[model samples]
Target: MAFRPLGRRAYGSIPHLPGSRTGPADRHLSPALARTLTQRARDARDHVVVLEKLDGSCVAAARVGDSLLALGREGQLAAHSANEARRLWATWVARHAERFLAVLRPGERVVGEWLALAHGTRYALPHEPFVAFDLMRDEARSPWREVTERLGNAGFVLPGLVHEGAPLAVEAVMERLGGAGFHGALDPVEGAVWRLERRDAQGVRVELLAKYVRPDKVDGSLLPENSGRPAHWNWRPEAPPPPPEMS
Candidate 1:
């Protein structure tokens, strides 16, 4: 049987996030998730985690049966994508197939940012190109603590940890992230992501993710297609040095 990777859902923007372009379906948080956020605001130690929001294409490596497949955000097999970045992601996955297969169970997928191609925030990466943020098996995500340990143990780089307590105002989160994030983003840090988990009525855990993007952020400001220049890669193995400038 062929593998069927699940598509990652678009994360909703926190209500206070400025200049968010979220559609109607993604603008509102579920009542339970909202309560979690509210509780976090009252207590500094509510179950909330904040991480540096990376600006890169969302991709995943899924171990299906005996094969590992590279997938785009929509769960399409990336090897067949027309986009060069997605194709490159497939090659990266193949190169690291052994690690992915070793760490993933039959139906699990490691979803993360593929930073090989610059998007809004380009990086001078301090680690491998792919920064795994979540371990999912369909719609459910592993809890934050487990996610950190699992992905870290599996030798995957993770997004910079920003905060883990009360929800901070956007300005505060940016201040903590500073001009360049831990990954060495050349431009302004785009924003931060908030993740919270709570048990449902059936006692099944539900994970929620919300984001706060900078109000002035311009999507894809650095891509070749948008910038009309040669591509700037965040990670290119054996990348050649740039030519000397003419006087």
Candidate 2:
């Protein structure tokens, strides 16, 4: 699997939007307030798709020769660091690697979330611990339907789809996350991830894939917690830079 790239913060503003504010970190916005409000680039779509933005470690798994290698955003972690979720994922990948290889072209990676023990529990999941989010081919994104169907057919639980229609405003999507899933079932979901489904001569790729997190029901830090044990290398979740922070 290929490493994930960063999505420079979504420069446009949405009222009450809590974007990627991190270490030194993504803390404040921009060098100056005026620049953030006027200069940052923002994307707006007529139709928006929002999936449950899960709280877990970013996982990338692939089939290498005869072994199934599980990786974090940074690099491969040892058996102990990988946790149960990742080990289970590696097994799943081993079982279905050939099935996925048959369909994927070249340079495509299966991006997902490993939720064995990251943040405290938020959702009621009793199925496979890891959930597939997207199929990435270099910088381009594949359509959501294609990614989920392929994995779902393999008897896996795909990420929950919240909204898939004309322009669900960012604020509204955030509002719904606090309550239930699409079917009105009470689920303590983290937040919603928004992406535009656009097709071109090349094919379908996820565009402006962005996230909106709920402070009340989500982990404040993006990184997974550690056991306070020291290691030679630290593990960090790899992701495209957050959409340019909306001023």
Whole-model Cα lDDT of every candidate shown, in order: 0.75, 0.51
* C-alpha TM-score for every candidate: 0.81, 0.62
Runs in model 1 lying further than 4 Å from the true structure: 1-46, 199-206, 238-247
User: How much is 176 displaced in model 1, in angstroms?
Assistant: 0.6
Where's the lowest-lDDT run of ten residues in candidate 2? 7-16
TM-score of candidate 2 relative to the true fold:
0.62
What TM-score does candidate 1 get on C-alpha atoms? 0.81
RMSD to the native, candidate 2? 10.6
Model 2 residue 209 CA deviation (Å) reads: 0.8
**Which candidate should be chosen as best, given TM-score against the real structure?**
1
Best by lDDT: 1
Tens digits of per-residue lDDT for model 2, 113-188: 7664445334445555567777665445667777776767766566677677555555666566666553222345
Report the number of clashing residue pairs per model.
0, 17
